[model samples]
Target: MSDTEGVEAEVAGAEAYAEAVDVLGPFNGPVLLAPVTHNPNNGVTDGVWDVTAGDRAAVLKVLTRSKGTTGHWAASDDPRHWNYWRREADVHVSGLAQLWRPYGIRAPRLLACVERPDGDVALWLERVRGGPGTRWTVRQHVEHLRRLGVAQGAVGETADRPWLSRRFLREYIAGMTPGQELLDDDEAWRQPLVREHFPAGLRHDMVRLHHDRDWFLQIMESLPRAFCHLDMWPANVRSDGPGSALFDWAFAGDGALGEDLGNYLPDSVFDLFVPAARLPRYAAAAYEAYLHGLRESGWKGDEHLVRLAVCASAVKYDWLTGMMLARAGEAQVDYGGDRPVSPELRYRERGSTLAFLAGWASEARDLAPRLGFPEAPSGR
Candidate 1:
């Protein structure tokens, strides 16, 4: 038989095949289950599976956290206050996705959810059939961003949910600041591989952002805040028949006006789902689309501030890349999907990621004259 048949046969024979059997009941036939590709984040060991249960095919997201795992803003590994998994379950159960169905945004149907006392949960969700946002073209990505902006722009503001992390960007970036694990790992930057990975035009700015803890916090917080899919990357989004579906609500909360695009613009390339060279094209498209969406949704806001926010928000990579450098022991920068740099996941894609991060710096520096934020001379 062909390779496809061989893999199917292997999947049929493997005992790993029957994970949620107890939870999902007997399938209509031999259950076809395979691991869904996802990036590893700060919190848990996630086993997101695609299972064909009888006539129905669904996604089984198995979330687990160990005693040693810690919880932070977006890293909701801890079950108690930082209920990332529970929040997602609640979002589906509460019919929040339906509210956005008209806005071209949607979430998967929650089929079954099992929560144990030990802070572990298993979510069986409807395998939203269609293309993932990662596969969308630059124009598609822009349209989706516009729809997202209109959707979120319409949301305006509201009373805070206690479950929502109040200062998400603040807390998420805190751990990687000076005197933190990120700066402590700066010595690793001395390595030629790690050093060479970044462009010379960017090295000083990258380091500046790393140590300038106060600026990152200040600018991100000062922007026009709104409810957003804090994690707006392609992997967490999918394109439905004519609509779109966004998943992974763990990071859905208040964010800068255009912060989601910051995630979207860079990540479309960072995930290596989009061609690296086209990243700038995607970034420009997404930016204009998002602004158009905001305007269409009746947002009477300052374009300059929004632009500044988008640029500053790009600093999201400051801590992330530093973490990769710190953790990358004397190894070749293969640019594969490993924890520290796993988000980029491809050698060819690394430059795009670095350029995007640097773009944020340069753009932000250019916007500072308009933003009126404090001046820290960027050694251009």
Candidate 2:
């Protein structure tokens, strides 16, 4: 199949430049639309662009889909799979984006938008000029967490919006059973790197989690829910601005308290965007800052529940760990042609990622007893 078939290419228009001017109103100079790739580790759901209209520059994003990416995903696994294609447009047009903008939980400003009769979407968004999220220092990340807590917490569960993220974990995993997919092939984890890196207790913890995920998922739902930037990894965030500038609202939704930081704490290292050693300080900074922000936003829920929710939410990545270990040797990271990541380095990185995931799973198991949730019997 050609590259243009998926949702990302749906708006690869011959007249995207003209459409931008026509929809957004007159500009002094000719508008040119150039296709570009922004951060797409999640999925290529949008055809992004750098649009130059005379002297003024802006970005044009057109939502697109490719079955190659979605071939494994069943609509039943995530009912919103089709509907979320228009989530960004929904956020802007619904005025929820505007509601969160001033609290410093801003996204790129929306200039204009269009909804095609065929159910496609195009957005004219302000080009945010800032540094990527990976470069932020611990203090900076703490403040980012603080501002994120305040901004999103300010909205809390009070946004009264139905389209906000719901069942994000199930929706995101599509149809793959992370535990079944991994445990079915124990030999895959026997690969040298995983065998060497995965801790014994953690492995035992993960196996038990596979069979008893429902209770843990229930625990996650019990926590106070609010709007969460579901894809808050370093690649999807920028910290160069005075505060955080979030993007990619496709995965934005109702999530348990502290869930975004669950991903935030481990992903920079998981993707090897930053060194693994920094994770401790980064996580420390994030939790404290977020709690402070939660209070700043007047959240009065039990702090202990938030802490429990953080570890419980690790359920989201249970399958991801197994899947990563099962497929151990794919060259997943692209270096923008600057340099190739040596296979040994990649192997080590993946091993480290598995180890980190194991720790989170173990935390879930360990935290359960404390939270009065029964521990699942070990599969070992």
lDDT of 1 by residue, 179-226 (tens): 235444556656555565555544455667666656766887878888
Each candidate: what lDDT?
0.65, 0.64
Tens digit per residue, CA lDDT, model 2, 101-196: 667767777888876554457787876667766665667667777887787667776454655667777555545554466664668768775676
The numbered model that scores best in TM-score is 2
Candidate 1 clashing pairs, residues 3+ apart or interchain: 28-54
Candidate with the greatest lDDT versus the true structure: 1
Q: Number of clashing pairs, model 1?
A: 1
